[model samples]
Target: MKIRVEKPKRPAFLVPAVIIFLVIAAVFFAVHSFTETSVPLAYEITGFEGQVQIFDLSNHEWRDPRRGEEFKAGQKIRTGVDGILNLQVENSVRLRVKENSMLVNRECKLQKEVEIYRLGLDEGVIFGAMAKNLDRKIADNKAEFVVSTPQFDAKPFGALFRIQASEKADENRVGVLRGVVEVSRPGSLSGKGPMFNVRALEEAEVMEGRVQSPAKISAETWQELKEGYELLAKSAVMEAEQIDLAQKAGNFFEKAVFDHGTFFTPKVGYAGREFFKDPDSGEVYLETEYDVFPAGSFVGVYIKTRDFDISKYEGLIFDARRKGDEGFPDSFFIELKSKGSVLRKYSARGFLREWTPVDFKFNAQKPTLINEVVFVFTNERVGESKKGVLEFRNFTLTPKKDPVPVAPAIPVNVTDIVSPPEIQSTPVSEPSAAPSNQTSGQETFDEMVPQTISLG
Candidate 1:
């Protein structure tokens, strides 16, 4: 019987099969653990400018919050006289607390398809920008916000809006740059409806629970406010070098130093739109696009400083580039126009798919103050030649001469604080660039002639 017994046959695949099964189980466990343990969404302090302080609810004391610091519900933040605090809530909404302002977080929820933020402004100004399509999502899913102040409570829905609260002035303001905001008194109706609806470019004031009629702001004022807040945000995030360059250029975009007032004769053009993209750096500086290939096609962003005299800046420096392949001309004219007399201009030959510098000096021969800056891309050639996108940016106004005294600082009233700061000529802002041995001056025709396109 012993001799007849055969050794038990081993299952050839048992060990390997068991090992594979264990590996699969381990992977599934890891994914399951990750899904089960969720980290709650929190408000992150993305950046700060000047002086900022935070009041912790648990600590019951104000402390300086670090960049990238996580703030939970019930924490409060304050910005001093020249301070700015930039925060991203639920990863969808950007909330900026301006100087002498305060913000307190209430609740934040990152739902399956949307995010919600509830907050309050005790006093001062708040700039809020919601990402595109996020406003529509609020109506589709649910109410996503509730912002409260002493005067009224609001639920803002849209891309850009602002709320300014002044306890001292007994004022509450709501301005919509892009979207709509539904507002009502504190502890008023729950679901029945909101009291007032403020639309894009519309503004309203609530004083002591009384909501005033909404009024549409002027296009110029709206543009100023938009630029003001954008500059604030940029300043909050900009590096040391970036701030230095921006300060030097007088911040044409942010400071609203210059504007494309009217085209002397524009065949084809677009304004305030993203029309140019850089080739190497890929940075879009200014929103100037022209596709005129005719005999005399010219367009420029004009500057109107009747409020002040800008006789100080004797020169201009900026970046310009033509868009397209080899068909378009690289020549353009940058004109510095003075209201009463002749205009000074520089003819430039430039490179397509790259940025070229247009640096010129304005003669003190004519009108005391420079009025407008215009770029004309004219092909005095035979006929309609080609199409291209002309872009401009990084403007540097040369050494400010003996500047006239700026008018007295405008009084900041309830309405005025909300208005954007207007740039006047007399009050020449000193560029914050470190004084180097190098200086900005007129780049003569002979200097850039070979590189410039032939217009004549």
Candidate 2:
């Protein structure tokens, strides 16, 4: 009787329809889960030093984060004098936050189609490294990665680069050690003005919404910045192996004239100074040409300025190179000047038509009045050829400051490249005015996908 009553109420269509709906729903969910990416919701703290503080988003509180603490999107972080912070992004990316600096995780949204990662530096410096072999072709790397500051924005495809925001000047400087970086001004996501590319050993300045062309930096000058950042973020064993304590650094570029000097070609032998950009790396260098060979005389260039009193500086730092020219002189000379020439000229080597970083230490006593600096090239050095193009940039007379610690060599290993769509940064629309300490030429940057400019 019970079985007959139950069977009488049952609908044949109802069971099948319900079962089909459940099957369809399960299939849809399984497909969606399979296509989703396994991205982390936050960056995990790896290491830290000094007095570091973080603003937690969940609790809305400022507190010290322990190792393995997570920094979510929009989390604010700052470091004190003794403060250094290290963080891991995914499995391949890393961040080193320097002392006396402030920054935030600007974006960490990984959607189905692509992911965008950004960090904002309000003041101070930060160094970042990313693996080169990232699978950019996959669906998640549309923006690649970027670091933004008060003055500019950097889209470093996969790079080792540093960002310094000067609290006083309200400007920002980016130093690239490896790979390629796209530099543009703030609010230029539309890439309003000319976009600049920076390569290894290059530095760019961003101020008042304009991007200075990239220029070469001395290895020591760069090391100071790079290693200093490393010291604050990582271990300080490498700092012990560096050069003398930094007393003071007089950046030749701080002045308007930039201590630009004359290339004395009194005779018919001529030389000219111009600025050129490397189309590939987007590096800027001052290009000077010695047109005709003149024996025992200089068709060279010099930079002398009374605007700066660099007496505190123990030596001068600059980078020089010769373009791919067999006609270029085999050697060049550097001179430092004051009321009287406290002359210790450095003989140029490594002029194999490539950029070379040189640190000219003072042989004599520090100059009494270092109001002038000079770089002289003459026909005396070359064996057969006297005419050539001299490429030079990064003229700084640094002072001796207290020794800063150095970081041990990081064991980051990267092999390969990343490729994404054309980012907001594009090539310069038109050639910028011929600027001091800049060079322009065609190089191949397009072929290298998802370039990384290493700060190290």
Candidate 3:
């Protein structure tokens, strides 16, 4: 200090420069913290009915989805006229897609603490619900579920809601059953249009990109909402049963010989077939009835196929049973055909009133391609009319069996063989007689018939 040492002078811009640097750093971090990070969400087909088709982005092809099939973002699902689809999303949301509808998974992302799901409904209806309890492990205010239509977007918060988009009518309808939904134009998320709050028991409609005021939900719509919930509940149970059935099926077959969902056309005399669900088991089966017809009549149903190959299979197996106490024939026929010409014929006989597994084994010299499968019920009883119902399910092709091992030949000398002495027979008391009404034995035959005759 005593020496005339000048204090190092600080730059006049030093403080401002430091402050500006801190400001830029803070700004950059704030923006970074607010930016959303993409999250991959799982979409699963919990259950489905009828002709539900999915356009998968992975392969860019439309195909039928089986239960428990997982889908990712950008996949589209469409339903046929009688189709219904159930979806479980991220273990937090459940959706029921109604018939004749098209839906797409548009976006899935994580923004800060919020998990987001955006679905697009190009047309038709969808019923959705958020997990209400802690069982789903989703915290409150942690998820955002939105369904967007061409006319509007429906944003539901912890709610059960239905959205129906009618492209032909140029309108979109939103019905809220629980919690609240915000109905707005398609770009309302970006503050582009007006929004309306649809509360429980209320509904609203959008026309020409304008959301109408919330109104009381109609009785018809209420019924529909109730049914949707019921269907969702049933689907959960159905999904569990389906998984169990699949596990039990194991690796026995490669493909179903006939699916319950397929359409069967009547090919011959006075026959009708319909899909029926068992009340006790909740399983669906095909119930085919042959009306009272004269002897020698052929009653059957046939499903069209396209180059279905069974060259690698050993046989066809199915479960079938007679449905009534009277008038059913003791036998039926299964035919694999190529363009209506018979390729193989199998006669299944002596099926009981209970479900029985029938297997028909065949050895083909070459690869067999079938164009159709026909189930024929014939009235072969002379001078008598026959009427009966039959139940069938689980028709599948069985895998080929492994070859048997051969034993080595053994040499024997004639002197080594000797005659043995016979013993006297012993008398024993017979067992008590069985019930008169009950038969002690039953037989079933699955004989392969010559394929010389065609049923076309």
Candidate 4:
């Protein structure tokens, strides 16, 4: 009987095959778990009142609304009750999302040629420091960027600025502070929709889901908008004065005047105190002629930096033009004087009888706190040039903000960890929808978008 059983038929060897398959699957999963790379860039929440949930698609699910948390991309941050969030994106960009504001990433891509951030600004304000490269293009090419509101049924393009965008209904107002921006409205009048450069400021009212006719803002607001610009222009003249005074020990700061167009207004020289004039056509030109120092008499425009502490400022930037005379004395100079000494000086180059952007970084050493800045046009050369005219505009003094606190220190020792017995904040009451000057009926808004501003 034992011989007839044929050694029990060897059980088909199925057990070993099953064991081997399980072992291979386990090894593959173990390797895959260790290879995935997460984003290295971090984000910190600077300020927030209530518990806000920020959703990031890539990493994990949720982020604390509290201060000092890391943030990654595709994160949808929701404000709880009354929440104010200040998020620092990519280290250099600062984003402050106001309460009741909802921002969604429509599309964002970083490619070889350009980085595009298409964001939806729904019911709030988003302030950003555009990437330095974009700033460079704006300063160099005079290129203008566009921002639009999509949900509203008029035009896709909304308010555009250098790096600021705001959306509000009824009493909505958006403006450009330093760079060029184009506002495009839907219509056959393609060339229309105002083009703002430098200090060209405007605001439009949104009603009934449409941007309506612009309302007049007070001069106080206008002054506030133009304040930073005026100070910047004055600083240029102040720099020139410091150099001239140091060279000869005289009062040049007080006598310094903005020699070129300020805020794109053609500087009125050989005329009264007005630097430029605004015609109905909105064409600003600089038509000024003055005999600069053929041997360095210090001819330049001044900008006052009274309210701003530019000690940490990185540089002075602006656009310049040399027209009419092909070989005029366009050699320029920039100098920064601190206390009683000329701290820094930079000689101009690449003046090729065309409009050019000039960016000069200031030395990190203590600056003159530049109450005045000067842009010098020198005529001291072999040419028989006596008068030098160089038109300048779009001046900006950029300061580096204090390094933003990145991550909260993590405690290692058990004794160092103090569980902050979670203190809760008093919730603010949400206001009901009340009509004010800033809000208007939807019907009125619909009629306003297409209506042209009556010239009469």
**How accurate locally, in lDDT, is each candidate?**
0.60, 0.61, 0.67, 0.43
Q: Which pairs of residues collide in candidate 3?
A: none
lDDT of 3 by residue, 292-348 (tens): 243356767665555567667777667878754434566667778776677677666
The estimated TM-scores of all candidates read 0.43, 0.43, 0.43, 0.35
Per-model root-mean-square deviation over C-alphas = 23.4, 25.1, 17.3, 30.8
Compared with the true structure, the alpha-carbon lDDT of candidate 1 equals 0.60
- lDDT per residue as tens, model 4, 170-263: 4344543322233333231246543322222334444544444443334444443432222122246644543433322112222332222222
Worst 10 residues of 4 by lDDT: 265-274
Name model 1 segments beyond 4 Å from true. Answer: 1-39, 111-114, 192-194, 218-224, 227-456
Q: Against the true structure, candidate 4 has what lDDT?
A: 0.43
Query: Which parts of model 2 have CA positions greater than 4 angstroms off?
Result: 1-40, 135-143, 228-456
Query: Residues 195-307, candidate 2, lDDT per residue (tens digit)?
Result: 89886557888767678999876535354444422322222332221111111112454541333434554443455554434445555556555533434666555555664
Per-residue accuracy of model 1 over 1-456 as CA lDDT, tens digit each: 457868998899999999999999999999986673323567788889898999977769999889999877778899899999878764357888889988888766665545667788888888887743455567677537778887788787754678888875455788865557887777653755348888655788887678788886654445434632352232233333343343333344344342333343422322222322334564545534333333344543444433223344556677766533213444656555556343456576645467677666543432354555555555452123223345567766675667588888866678645666876767668879986863333343222211222322
Predicted structure 1, TM vs. truth: 0.43
Candidate 3 global CA lDDT score: 0.67
Better model by lDDT: candidate 2 vs candidate 4: 2
